[model samples]
Target: MDNITNEEKQQSIEAFQSVIRKSENALASMKSGSAQSRLLEKRLKAARIGEGLLAARWEGKELDVSHDELVEAKQVLEGLLLMLPGFLEKTKPGSGQRTYIERRIKAFQMAVSYLNE
Candidate 1:
């Protein structure tokens, strides 16, 4: 894994914080056990994972997965990226849910990039 500058790490942490807050607010309004709620929960989990990964990388302890595992993860995230637009379309424009989806897309893209590197 490439070493990230401190400036980049700080910016990423801040971005993750914003995404987490939005996701939490959106999830609070969603009915528990519903499909939408479940999906948002997954996205929230991803965001937390991404944040932890960033921190680990910054500490010079990047993930020790095999190259094959990284490639597989990147492929999975790519597939999700292709499907997210349909999910985004189901939400109202300018709504908190839509914003959360957008943030999720961004988080997934960031993960893909990290895996690619």
Candidate 2:
């Protein structure tokens, strides 16, 4: 594989920073009871699980064998991605919370794409 260029590395770093900012903002914005808030929580959980799986794969930890398991993971990720647009559309911008949720959802979508590849 070709080495990542300096510009590419910088972009990657910036993207990661953006995701962190977004997550922080989303957490701050969450309320105790609201549909949007609930959806955001659910999406965040899904993203975390996806991140865990990806991290495990990167660390060369072999997951237990099962065709059904792989299929379920993919299906769930896809379903979460599909739910993003609706959640994003409904969320209001208060204290920059919506922006953060949007960023996280986008990040999760990108992760799903990477996994598919």
Candidate 3:
């Protein structure tokens, strides 16, 4: 398999950061604001942190991951999805931002599902 270049890794990190920012912004916009927003925000923060750790691992700065870290990251992504309904309902369905968030949610769900298998 071909190894990912530094530029590719950086781009992946930036994309993940953009998803985190969008999620945060969406949560902040919800008027019905529930505890779920807080939960999702916390999970998204953890996911971003996990992405950083993964980047370090990719860079050979980390030794290895234990079973627990992998599990925690999976759980964080799941938590983010669990909070999505509230935010999704608030978004106008056809708006570009809403569409982007929906796509991100779908992508995140697919990743979590793949990790679980």
Query: Each prediction's Cα lDDT score?
Result: 0.71, 0.56, 0.64
Model 1 residue 11 CA deviation in Å: 0.7
Ranking by lDDT: 1, 3, 2
Candidate 3 lDDT (Cα, 0 to 1): 0.64
Please provide, for model 1 over 1-117, each residue's C-alpha lDDT reduced to its tens digit, 9 standing for 90 to 100: 256566656666666777678899999999999999987786676666666566666676866556665565566557778998999999999998787677667656767777666
Among all candidates shown, the one with the greatest TM-score: 1
Query: TM-score per candidate, in order?
Result: 0.57, 0.46, 0.52
Please say which candidate is ahead in lDDT: 2 or 3. 3
lDDT by residue for model 3 over 1-117, one digit each (tens)? 125566655555565677778778888786545787876676666556555654665665752556676677778877777887778888997997676567556556544654565
What's the distance in Å from true for residue 87, model 3? 0.6
Deviation in Å, model 3, residue 67 alpha carbon: 1.6
Write the residue-wise lDDT of candidate 2 on 25-108 in tens digits: 787777856887665555455445555544444456854535554555556657866876887787786746576556556545
- Rank the models by TM-score, top first: 1, 3, 2
RMSD of 1: 6.1
* Best candidate, lDDT: 1
Off by over 4 Å in 3: 1-15, 20-64
- Reference-based lDDT, residue 78, model 2: 79
TM-score (C-alpha, index-matched) for candidate 2 = 0.46
